[model samples]
Target: MAIQLVTDQLSNVLDDTLRSQLVGNFKEIEKALNDLDGAQARLNSDQDKINQDLKNIKDGNEIRDVNVQAIVNILTKYDVPIQIVNGKVVDTTKEGE
Candidate 1:
C-alpha cells in the first residue's frame, strides 16, 4: 500500500521545469523517508523473528531491551516516528501537510 504511494509520488515530485527551479530540500527529505521506511521494515521483520524465537525457546535466555532500543534509534535518526498501536505500525503523518 505505502509502496504504491511512494511510486506515485516519485513520478510527480520532479518534472523537468520544477526540477530546475527547486527551492527546498525535497530530494533529501524523500531520501530520508525512503531510508526510514526501509529501516522500519527491517526492524519489524526482526521483531517478528524475535517473537518466533521466543515461542520456540525452552531455556532461560531472555530478550534484551537494548535490541528494541537499537531499532528505535534507527527510526529516530531518520525523523520517522513509528506509531505502534495494538502491535501494528500505523502511519501518523498527515497527507500533503
Candidate 2:
C-alpha cells in the first residue's frame, strides 16, 4: 500500500498537498529557531564580557576611567542609550525625571 493511498484517492491527494505544506511550514519554523539560537548565543557572549568587566570592578581592581569610557562608547555604538555618571553606566531610558 502507498503511504498516501486510501479508500478515497481524492482525499489522499489533498492529504499529500497538506503534508507538503506542513513540511514547508516546519522548514520555515526550523530556520527561525536557528536564527533565534544564534542571537541567544551572541547575547550570552556579550553578557559574559559584561560579567567579567563587572567582576573586575567588584574585586576593587584599578580600572581607568578611559576603559569605562570605551565600554560606554561600545554600548553607544549599538544605539543603546546610556549615561555615565561618577564612573557608573546607567540606562538613560530608565531614569525617573
Best by lDDT: 2
| Model 2 clashing residue pairs (backbone) | none
Per-candidate Cα lDDT values, in order, are: 0.62, 0.75
- Cα RMSD of all models vs. native, in order, equals 25.9, 16.2
- For 11-90, candidate 2 gives per-residue lDDT tens digits of 34557766766676677777777988999999999999999999989665455666778888998999889969876888
Deviating ranges (above 4 Å) for candidate 1? 1-24, 58-97
lDDT for each residue of candidate 1 in 1-97, tens digit (9 for 90 to 100): 2322223234354676455334234665677789999999999999999988877673323344345556666786798876555644555678886
Q: Give per-candidate clash totals.
A: 0, 0
